[model samples]
Target: MIFKNISKSKLTLAFISIVITFFVWQQGLRDSLNRPSVTFDISQKEQEIAELSLQSIPVNLKKIFIINDPVDQINKSLSDVSFEELTERNKLIRIITSELNDPKIYKNISKDFENKNFKFLIDEIEKKSNNNSYKPSPDTFDLFKGDRFLYHLLSRKFDFDDSALITKSFSSKMFLKILAIRLIPLFTILIGSILALKILWTTIALKKFGWKEIKYLDLELIDMVLLIAGGFVVLGEVVSPLFSISLVELFSRNISNELSQSLKIFFGYLFMAIPPLGIVYYQIKSLNGEFNFKKDYLQFNFLPIKYAIIQGIKGWLTIVPFVLLISLIMNSLIDNQNGSNPLLEIVLNNNNYLSFFLLFLTTTLLAPLFEEIIFRGILLPTLSRNFGVISGIIISAFIFALAHLSLGEMPPLFVLGIGLGITRIASGSLFSSVIMHSLWNGLTFLNLFLLRT
Candidate 1:
């Protein structure tokens, strides 16, 4: 009966995964179709023209003064100016001055050439050229202009080119690309969810079949508090200082900024991982023979691979909506803040592959392994035993969120911690929670990568 139930659940999950994959593929196709056909080449040419016209102003103005009709004279002067001569600032100035003098051409002038001082000059030219009898339309002059506004405008236009290129590059093979990008995290989530359910089912079945009561080491409340506090101090006081200031100063003196930064991140996390693991080991050792190697210590027990994977997927599914909601709210509230994880910022900004690899390793692998052991393996269980399950989960989860020291991120982190705690209890193994945490970080890393590319 249990086998039949498990088989049915697997089929349902497979169907859901297939449906989601199809939906994502369809959306990607729709996005590609709606993408703009425009390219950066047109904008680049316009910028060149604006620069050339600005430089040719003086020469064209001379022609404008010699002719009765400034519009025809300026147009003829512009047509004569060679592209090579446009590189000279003086020639560019002449061309721009000629364009401003002609009402018809000036009306269609690029906003790049319209500046406060330039407009004042144009008004002065009109007063002198027409003897205050004829005036160009007010629309030809920009009211609000700044220094080097043209350069700024060019930069802004160039920024959208990356996204435009991505849209244009989409093909029939896009489904394969999307699947490849998302596959690892999707599998991790699915397997984790399944493992969690299987573990719960197994525990219930065993209890009904007269399984013996599980026993844990007799840890005092003070013992739990001390261990937690010790880990925090080691991370905050010992590891943080080395990374934040000392290592940076030391490395800056000896190496390039890029190498120094990479070394700092690698060594910082290395040091951070050691101390917590050492502390946990020490605490377990202090329990003497009372600590059951297989069952009492959550980290020591090996959950069935299938059950572990299912739990991870379930935990991720439970927390994803809350994580997304908090992320949206936080982003809206702190819109000015760069919407990037610090580790992600380092990964994206640095060109050094070694540095990128080190950063990724620290965040995705080492951080998850050590943190899950400390929080879920040690803290959550200890707290649950001392303070009852609900209070322990809530309290430990709150501390986990607080440790991040980000108000904007606290809500999401807190929710994630709760999910991890629930998985710890349901699966009765630290490994399940570790898998979930790693998968969550992996998903976030992938998200940032997509946004950047």
Candidate 2:
């Protein structure tokens, strides 16, 4: 009906919609540039209560031979040695003290002494206790105390600067988790508003919009296809360029870097490449006639796959502007003890523009593919099944935010989570969610590159 009402005069309105979308995206990127990528969960599970040390003792006295000889026998042979003599080697002192306190020293590590390997230490301790002359030699006791000091010293940890991991609620870091719950729904509303506006604008243009988005956000088959295809293109064009197969140092900061990199690679193969080529490996056994839930969810008919992708892009173009607007607002508000901005640091963090580009590609492309598989594909279906669709969307969105571990997630992240979930449900396809998720992240990457610079 709107199209029937349109004339050449309306064509100008269509161009205006696209320009508005780009402006909003650029603004959001500028704001998000300074935001930090999350590294840990913000749930108020266990307060640090006290700082823990990470530096191990400076000494390497992991082993020393102290035989079970009598106190009189030991005292006579080592008469010239005083209590101070035992501590000559710091490592030796550590070993002696750790052994003296049976629980503190060998207790944790003893389990790892593979191949029936731990009997020697167990036997020595047991044998000493069995003998009547087990007076606990004075020099050995001194050695034990010194080692305890070293154990505590070497385990020094980074000062838990609550500043490094703060969420920007009106209150301090202590109450961030509580505020997050309340904020989740509000963020959903804001994101939904932005998406709706973008959708209307896209409709006015010739870009094509989706079917009436399920008011509650359920993706039809077509929605899924479009999301996957657009997201995949962005990933292939932007993300694949970040590959650094030979560089190890780039990943040094990542704890599960190797395993994560491998999984990312696997997903990249599945979604970004020609489908069923890899996905079919699962289906070859049952590909003949029956298409069950397993097949419906996992298997693909190329026609539907291609159709769905076209739909997803049309849907995304309409809604993308709103996503960009919220993201910009989310990124702009700053949080840091050192007053560091993630946006500024993007370039400063990587002296090599190539590395920065790699970071950009990975964030925009790779993360969305894997994340969608987990969140929209795996998590949303699982959660929606557990708690009706609405509950699933809320909880899945929360988990999405929590999944991204880092200090900087306090802002638009929760909103992004909700957006990702809604997009998946609305399209009734994981691809829709992937497009939205990648768009959100890609905007941030652009923030780092375009705005922060």
Candidate 3:
């Protein structure tokens, strides 16, 4: 009767945990819907990259890429928009790209910007465009440093001696941007397609392509509820941040906003990890009656490191196409979808080296390690032991996606989680899933880095 009562109590607690987690996840997703999507930012970067490429790309390369005449393209983009609708930056780009023989164009753009320095720069550019001699000032030198291509073009018009030097520098930067923008997608699709076919063939042959049940440390359903709900959601996400943020606020008062924000994220993640990890440790100790790292822990087999790495690579490649397909479908179905993670915008816009490094560490290294340990290493195997392996993989992936609290991103993230779960089971190593997750995030980081001007 006591045993039955204990089981009933555990079941009731598990039910409560599910209800709380669901409510929290729903609120988070709803909140995310109000945030601006990252796709807009990505589009802006693409436009910037394209504009810069047109300025310095070789004529032969432009022909190969089928890039249209940049002046015509810029005119088309600005055609329907009135002067008031155009941003200050867009106005500057338009004025720089235009033939300044039109006096109205010069007056309209220069008069709208109230800043004397901005007006002065516009006036000089107009003079240079019209073959009227204008003395170069320190602001012009700053412009030369800030935007070498714009400076080089203006210098060529004014017949400045340093135009050739600026041209060389501008060309090198444009080459890298163009190469990265064009090659990254092609490389991903090609590798992904090859791996996708291999995965299909392996599935048909019934050979090493599915999630397999593994013998893991004994854990009850209530233990999972305690770890995920009490430890992760309640303590890690909620309670722990209270302390972490307080500490960061105390120490980072004198720092720049960017640096302070970075510290908060870094320390916040560390603190959040502690409670769940502590729970894991405690549960392991309780279950085994003693802690033996090698014998009584999640599987992180690294003996065949090469095989694990290869499997991880293969899993990442195979999943890329599926995830991309889901993202495309979502985009097609939803217009201006919100709920992109705000971290993406921070990474894209951050100029400070120290802050960027901290973010890089959090995303590429720490996130993969901690997330894989929790989801695939522990949660997956425990769930798999209770349910069927396939059910376990799906359920765990769903939970993983929910934990991210992004509605727009959940489908792709869920797909990616499934891939990680499959990799974890098929390779029989938590190390493989960790590698795959790291590679996924590292690729995103690299893309964002390349997009930086």
Q: What is the TM-score of each candidate against the true structure?
A: 0.53, 0.36, 0.82
CA shift of 316, model 3, Å:
1.0
**Candidate 3 residue lDDT tens string, 306-365:** 998998888888788888899999999998788998888788878778999999899988
Most lDDT-accurate candidate: 3
Which pairs clash in model 3? none
The local distance difference test score of each candidate is 0.54, 0.41, 0.78
lDDT tens digits, residue span 368-424, model 2: 776676456645655565466778778767655543323344334556666666666
Task: Write one digit per residue (lDDT tens) for candidate 1, span 1-453.
Answer: 112233555455445544543454345434433432111112222232232233233554534322233323333544554634332322333444443445434333323343545455434444534453544443323331221222222222222222222222332133233334445546655655675576568768887422212234455554444455444443433455566667667646866676678777777766666655676667677667444555546553454778877766677766775566676686577533321234554554465667667767777788888788778777776777767777878998987876554444567888889888877776666777888898788776564443222
Best by TM-score: 3
RMSD of each: 19.4, 21.7, 4.6
| TM-score of structure candidate 3 | 0.82
Please state the error at residue 365 of candidate 3 in Å.
Answer: 1.1
lDDT of 2 at 140: 29
In model 3, the runs with Cα more than 4 Å from the true position are: 1-20, 64-166, 207-213
Show how many residue pairs clash in every candidate, following the order shown. Answer: 31, 42, 0
